[model samples]
Target chain A: MLISSIYKIPIVILLLSGSLFFLGLYPDISTIIGGVALFLIGMEYMEGGFKAFSGSFLEKILEKFTNTTPKAISTGFFTTALVQSSSLVSIIIISFLSAELISLTSAVGVIFGSNIGTTTTAWLVSLFGLKIKISIYAMPMIIVGIFIPMFLKESSWKGIASILIGLGIIFLGIGYMKEGFEILKEGIDLAQYAMSGYAGIFTYVLVGIIATIVIQSSSATMAIIITALATGQIEYTNALALAIGANLGTTVTAVLAALKSNENGKRLAVAHFIFNMTTGIIAIVFIYQLAELVDYIAMIIGIGIKNYTLKLALFHTIFNVIGVIVVSPFIGTLVAFLNKLFVSKKQSKGKSKYLDDSALGLPSTALSAVIMETKHLYENAFGIIARGLNLKKKNILSSMDLDDVVADLYTSDTIDIDDFYNYWIKGIYGEIIDFSTKAQINMAPEYAEELYKLKLANRDIVEAIKGTKHLQKNLLKYTSGRNRYIKEQYDDIRKSLAKLLRNIHTISTSNEEDVIILLLSKSKIHAERDDIIANGTLDRLIRKGLINNQMATSLMNDSDYAYRISQNLIAMAEVLFIDIDSDLKKLHVDMGISDEEAKSIVQKKDHS
Target chain B: MSIKKFIESVKASLNLNKFEQKGKKKAIKRLLQKLESRKEILAKIHKKKLKKKDLKELREEQEIVDLQIKKGKKLLDELDG
Candidate 1:
C-alpha cells in the first residue's frame, strides 16, 4: 500500500521530482507529462461513465454471475474490459463483499479475471491508438460524444457520451505520447539505458514499478510503455520487465484502497497482492523464454517480427493468464489462508457490524450496508424491548401463544432497561446515523430517499426501546402485585406487545407481500385496541371501582406507553420489511392500511 | 435521425416498451393468487367451528384480504388501460 502516514508527501514529491528530472532534459517532456495527465483524466471520465451507466445492471450481473469460481472469473474479466477499469471493478467487488452480497471466493476469482481483462488496454494502445491517425478518430469521437448529450436528456445517453469522449481523449494522449517519445529518440535513445541480461531485466522491472507507482496508474504506464516500444524509444526486453513492474505497482493501489475497507476487502487486497507478486516473479524469472514463446505465437497470429508493441501486449496477457492458471488451483488454499489472516475482530453488542467504510464506495452498497446494519439495530432493540416486557425473546420468536409468552418472564427481578439500552442501542444508532450521513453525499436521489427511510426506521426502533423503558416500570409493579384486576391488565399489556413482536418477526422473514401486509394491518388493528380509554376497558374498570385513582392513572399512562411501543415497532417494520420488493413497495404506498382504517377496524370490534 | 428518436426506435425494436408495467401486472397477479389461497385457508378455518376469538380474528383477516383483492384488481385494470 502507498504510505499513509508522515512519509506519503515526501515519497510523492520525490517521485514527481524524479519524473520531472527525466523530462527537464528534453523539450518534449511537457507533452509527455501532459499526455499522462490527459490519460489519467480520460480514465477518470471513463470510470465515471461506466459507473453511471451500470446503475443496478452491473450489481445484478455481478451478483448473478458469481455463483461459481470460473463464472466469477469470467464475469470479472468481461466486466473489467467493458468498463476499462480494474480498480473500479475491485472497488465494486470490495463493496459487494462487505455488504455480504457476494462471497470472498467469488471476489478473488473476479480479481484474477480483471488482471487478464486489464491487458486489453495494452492491445488497444498498440493496435488502434498508435497505428492509426489519432486525431482523425479522436476529434470525431470527441465531437460526437459532446454532441450526443445535447440532443438526448437521458442519463444513459450522457453515460455513452462520456465513454466516447474518454476513449477519444485516451487516443489523443497516446498520440501525444508517441510524438514525445519519437522526438526524444532524436536527442538520445532511451534504449541505451536498457540493461542487458538479468541485470537489465531487474533494473527495468524496478523502473517499471517506480513508473507505475509515480504515475499512480498502471494503465497509463502501460500505454506509455507500448507507445515508447512502438516508436523504438525503448527495447522490447526492458518493456517486458516494466510490464511486470506495472503489474506489481497496481497492487499498491489496491492495498491502499483496502486500508479503508472491511475484512473482506482486506482479504481480497492480500489475494490481489499475492496474485500479482507471484505473476511478476514467474514472468521475471522466465522473461527470455516468455519472449521467445511470444514470438512464436506472434508469427502464428500473423504479427510482424518487428511489432514489439503487439508482442509486449501479447506478453502482458500471457503472463497474467499463466498467473491465473498457475495460482487458480491453489485458490481454495489461498482463501483458507486469507480467511485465517484477516479475522474480523469479535465486536461488542452495540458496535456497527455492517457500516464499514468499504460499502460507502457505492450508493447501492452503502444503502445495502445501512439496511443490514439497521436490521442489526432492530435485533438489538427487539431484545431490549422483549426484556422490558419481561418476555423471553426465544418464546416470542417461537410459535408459542402470545398468552404463554406473557407468562414466560425473562427474569424474576426487575431488568435494567437503561443498562441494556446503553449496551446495545446507543452506539450502533449513532454509528448508523453517522455512516448514513457520509453515505448520502454521492447517493442517487432514490437511494438517498431509501437511506432517509432507513434512518427513520432506525429512529423508530430506538423510540420503541424508549417506550419499553417507560412501560417496564409499571409493568413489573402491577404484574406482581396482589390486585388481580390490575395484574390481569398488566399481563394483557404484555400479551399485546408480545403479539406485535411475534407478528413483526413473521413479516421480517416472509417474502410474500400479501402475508406481510396482512400481518402489518392486523398489528395496526391490535395497536388501536391497546387504547384503554378508547376501548372502554379503562372506563368499565373505573366504574366498577376495581382500581383506585392512583392505580387508574398508572394504568392509563402505562397503557399509552404500551400503545406507543406497538406504534413505533409497526412503523419500523413497515419501512424495513416492505422494502423486499419494488412491487411490494408501490403496493404498500397505495394500499397500506391508513390510521383511520385502523381506528375503524377497532370500532367495528367494539360494536361486535 | 435525432439521437432521442434513434433511441426510441431501438427501444421499440427490442420490445422494451412498458417493461415496468408488465412487471407490476405480474406482481399484482401473483399477490392476488396468494390472497385467494389465503382466503381458501381462512374459509377452511371458518368451517371448523373455531372458538369466538379465533373466529373473530379470521373474519377480520377475510375482510382485509377481500379489500386488498378489490384494490389489486382495480390497480391492475388501471395499468392495463
Candidate 2:
C-alpha cells in the first residue's frame, strides 16, 4: 500500500496536466506526448526488425568483439546508437550473461554502451523530426508492424510488432504534445514568467533529470524539453542545459545496478557517469560554439537548420560521440578508478546483491548481472563447504552422535537453500515453464530447453548449498564427540567439498565452455566423496560401539538418501554439459541406488 | 508424424559439418540417440496396452523427446547457416 500510494504521485501529475492544458498554461502537451510515443514506437520497430534481421550476426559480433572492456563498451554503445535505446541492448546482454551464454565483461560493456545508445534519442528529438508530422511514415510502420505477424511465420516478426507499436505510441504522444503546446501558445501568460530567474535554467535541468529518472527514459525527457522550447517558455540555452542534465541523469540505472554489483558492475556505472559528466561539462564550455557550429553547418547546407530543437539534438549527438572517442581508450583506467572508489565497506563484506526486480524487463542483462552475483554466492558456498570439512579439534570426535546424524539424514535438512536461486533465473525460468502449457501455441522448442537448463542449473546450486549446510550440521555434531577418526573424516570431506565448490565457482563465473564442463565433472566427484563419507562413517560407528545391529541397517538407509539428494543436484549441473537421458540414467543407475531406495536406505541405517 | 520417424528425420539431418565444433556435433548426436531410444521405449509401452499410470510417464518422456529433437534441429540449422 505504501509503494502504491507513492506511485499515485506520477498518475496525479499526469491528470493535473489535463486541467492545466484546459487553462492553456502548459503548451505542446499533445505534440510532446505524440512525438515521444512515435519515437519510442519507431525505435522499437526498427530495433526488432534489425535484431531479427541480424540476431545471428549480432551474436557472433558480440562473441568476437566483447573480448576487452573497451571493445565491449564500444560494441554496446554502437549497437544501441544504431538501434536507438540502450535498454534493449542492456536487456539482451543481461539475459545472455545470466544464461552464462556470454562473459561478464562483455555484458558490462553492453551496459555502458546502452547509456551511449540512449543518448541517440535526445539527439533524434533535437533534430525536430518529431515536429514534421511523420504520420504518413507512421501509417506504413503501423501497418507493417501490426500486419507482418499475420503474413510471416517466424517469431521475430512479433518482435517487429513490438517495435512498430512502440513507434505508434511515440508518434501518438508527439501529436498530443504538439496540441498541448499550441493550446498554451494561444492562451497562457504562464510562459512569460516561467523563465523570470537565472535559476530557472538549473531548475529545468534538474527537472529534466528528475522526469527521466521517474520515467526511466532520457528520450521522454528530451521530448519534454523540445516541447518547452517549441512553446516559447524555455529558451534554447536552457533547453540545451536540460538536455545535458538528462544525459547525466539516465546514468542512474547503471549506478543503481552497480550499487550491489561486483567490481565489474561498479566499473560500468563509473564509465557511464564519467562519460556523461565529461560530455555535459564540455557542452557547457562550448555552448555558443556549438550553437554557431550548427548554424554555420545549416547555412552551408542551405537546409535551414534554424529550428532550435534540431540544433539541440545535433549538439547532443556530436557531444556524446566525441566524448566516447576521447574516453573509450581510458576505459581500463576508469574501471580501476571506480573499483578503488566503490570498494565494498568492511562491515558488509561478501554480500553482493544482484539482479534487482528493476532489471526484469531487460531479462538478459538482468540475468547477466545475477550470474555475476550467483558466481559470488557459489564461491561462498564452496568456502563454507571447505571450512566445514577442515575444522580441526581433537575433541570434536568425542561429540559424535551417529544416531542423530543418521536420523536427520533420513529427513531432509531444514535450511532454505533457495537463496541461491537468484530472481533473474526465477523470472526467466518461470516464463519459459509457464509457456510450456500453451498447447496450441507454436513456439521454439529450443526456447524451453534454454529455460530448462537455466532452471536446472539454479536448482543444482541450491541443492549443493543445502548439501553443504547439511554436512556442516552433522559434522559439527560428530566432531564435538572427541572421536579422532570421525573428526579427521569430517575434515577430509570438508576439504573435498570445498574444492568441489571452488571448481563450480570458477566454472559458473567464467564464460569458457570447457571450464564449465570441467566444473561439472568436478562436481560429479562430490558424489564419490559422499560415498566415502558413508563408508567411512559406517566404519567409525562400528569402531565406537555406536552402531548396534539395528543402527547399522539405519545407517545404510541414511547413506542412500543423502547420496540420492547429492546426485540429484549434481545431475542438474551435468545437465548443462550432458543431455537429459544420459544425466537421468546416470542418476538412476551408475551414481547410486534408486531415489526411493536411497531415501529408505538412510532410514533403515538410523533404525539399525 | 509418428514420433519414431520424426526422430529419425531429425537424426538423418544431423550432419557434423553443419556443426561449428566437435563438441556441438557430439552433443547433438547424443541428444538425438536419447530421444530416439526414449521414443521407441515409450511407443513399445503404449503398444503393450499399458495402464494409464504406466502410460503417464511414457507421455512425459515422449513430450520431452519431441522437444529435444526440435531443439537440436533448430540449433543445428542456426549453427550451420
Candidate 3:
C-alpha cells in the first residue's frame, strides 16, 4: 500500500504540472494532446489487429529462422516491418524465451533487427503523413472498417477491420496534429526559442526522451516530431536530438518491465536496455557527422535539402543500422554478461514457468504461455505417476526392456503422491486455470474454443494424478509377495502401465504424424488390457479360488483406477500434443479409434 | 438485401467456403499416402514371423490403419460431395 501510494505521487504531480501548462496554452494544446491520444489509440488497435495473425504463423517463422544469429536478425527485421509493432514482436520473443522455445542469443538478435525495423515508421510518417489530405482517406476507412466484420463475421476479417480502423484513426490524428501546429504557430513561433550547438542538442534530446517515456511509444513520438518539423514548429537539429532521446526512453520502459519479470525475462529486458542505450548514446555523439551523411543521402535519393522531416527519418534509420552493425559482434559477450548478471533466484518447482502478466497484452502470447505451463505440469505429473506405479521414470523414458523396467521398483516404501501433488502439480494447475480465464476476454471465438479444450486437458491432468494417487495405495501392498495369482495380476498391471508411459513419452517426442497415429492406437489397446472385469480375468481368479473376496475387491478397484489413469492421460495427450496446425491434426480424431472401435479391437484380440 | 443474403452472395462469388475444404482434402490425401506405406511396412513385418503376442499386436495395428484409410476415403468422398 505504501509503495503504491509513493508510486502514485510522481504520476499525480506530473498530471498536475501538465494541467497547469495546458491551461496556459489551452485549446490549441488540447487539440495537439487529443491528437496524440488518438495516435496511441490507433496504434493499440493496429497492434491488436496484427496480433490476430500470431498463432502458428509467427511461431513457425521464428522457429524456422532463429537457428542462427543472422537468420534470427532477418526474421525479426522482416516480421516487425510487416507487423508494424516492434513491441508485439518483443512480447512474443520474451514469451518464447521464457518458454525456452527460442534461445537467448537468437532472441537478442531479433530485438536488434526490430530496432532497425521500427525506423520504417518514421519513414512512413515522413513520406505520406503530410503530403495528402489524410482525412479524406480516414473517414472512408473508418466507415469501411466498421462495416467489414458486420458482413464477414470471421476473426481474420475482424482483424482486417481493426487494422483499417486503426490506420484511419492514425491518419485522422495526424491531420488534427497538423492543424493544431498551424494554429499554435500563429501565437508562438517555437522556432524563435531554438538554441544552437551542444547545449541545444542536449536540451532537445532530453525533451525527446521525456516525450517518448510519456507516450510509451517511440514511433508515435517520431511521428509527432516529423509532423511538427513539416509545420515549421521545430528546427531539424532539435528534432534529431529528440529522436536520440526517444531511442533512450525505450530502455527505461524495458528496465521498468524487467522489475517484475522472471530471470530470463529480466535478462532479455536488460539486453534491450543495453542495445537501446548504446544506440542512443552513439546517435548523440555522432549527431553532426550523421546529419551531414543524411544530407548526402538525401541528395543521392533526390529528396530536397529543405525536406527536414525526411532527413530526420533517414537519420533515425541510419544510426539504428549502424548500431546493429557495431553491436552484432558483441552479442555473444553481452549474452554471457547478462546471464551472469541476472541469475535466476532459487525458483520453486511449483512456480508457473511461462505464465506472466506481460503476456496478457496479446491473445497469442497468452495462449502460448498457458500451453507451455500446462506442458510443465504434465512433466511433473509424468514424474509422479511413474513413481506411483513403482517404476523409474527414466527407465520408462529410456529404451529399457519392459520386464526390466517393471522389475526395477521406484520405491521400496509407499510413495507419498499427495505430498508430491501439493508441492508440484497443484500450484501450477491453479495458475493455468486462472490465466486461461483472463486470456478468454480478448480471445476470438476460435481461440476461446482452444482455451476451453486446454482447460479440459488441464482437468484431465489433475484427474489422472488423482487416479494415480488412488491406485498407489494398493500397488505397494499387493505387489509385495502376496498370493501368486494376484501378484501376477498386479505385476501385469505394472508392466502394461509402464508400456503406456513409454508410448506416451514416445508420442510426446515424435513428429511423424503416422508414427503418432500408430502409437496412439497402440496406447488405447494397452489401456484396455487393464480392464480385468470386462475380460473376466478377475472372475476367473475368484472362481478358481486363487484369491479371497477382499483381494478381489481391491484388484477390481485398482484395475479401474489404472484404467482411468490411462484414459485420462490419453485424453490429455490427444488435446495437448495431437491437436496441431496440420492435416494430421484434422484427421487425427477421425483416424484415432473411438471407444467402440477400441472395444471392437479388444474383442477381436480376445477371440484371437 | 438481408445480411444473410449479402453474406451468401459474397461467399458464393469468392468461393471462400472451398478454402477449408481444399486444405482438408489435401491433408486427407497426404494421410492416405502415409497410411498405405504403413500397411506395406506392417505386411513386411508379418513375413518375418513374430511370436504369438507380438504378432497379434502387429495385426491389430494394421487393422486400425486400414480402418483409418477407409474413414479417410469416406471423409474425402463426403467432402467431394
The candidate scoring highest on DockQ is 3
Better of 2 and 3 by lDDT: 3
Query: What TM-score do all the candidates reach, one by one?
Result: 0.86, 0.53, 0.91
Worst 10 residues of 2 chain A by lDDT: A1-10
Give the candidate order by descending lDDT.
Answer: 1, 3, 2
Alpha carbon lDDT of residue A191, candidate 2? 56
Question: How much lDDT does candidate 2 score?
Answer: 0.53
TM-score of model number 3: 0.91
**Greater-DockQ candidate between 2 and 3:** 3
lDDT of 1 at A592: 74
DockQ of all models, two decimals each: 0.31, 0.04, 0.62
Candidate 3 residue-wise lDDT, B1-81, digit = tens: 997888788888888778778988998888889989999988887546688878777777888898888888999999999
Regions more than 4 Å wrong, model 3 = A1-31, A183-188, B46-48
Candidate 3 lDDT over A335-413, as tens digits, reads 9999899875565888888887667756777777888888899999989988898989889888988889988988899
lDDT of 1 by residue, A1-608 (tens): 22222322444355445457767666576567667766776776777677666745677888899989899999988988888888778777877877678888999999999899999999988888888877578889889999766655455667788888988888788877888888878877888877789998988888888887767778988999998898788888989999999999888866875676678878988999999999999999999999999999999999999999999999999999999999999999999999999987888888988888766666777877888899999999989888898999999999988888888889989999899999998999999999999999966566788889999999999999998888889889999899999999999999998999889999988877888989998999889988887899999999999998999999999999888888899989988977643578867866677878889978986887
Sort order, DockQ high to low: 3, 1, 2
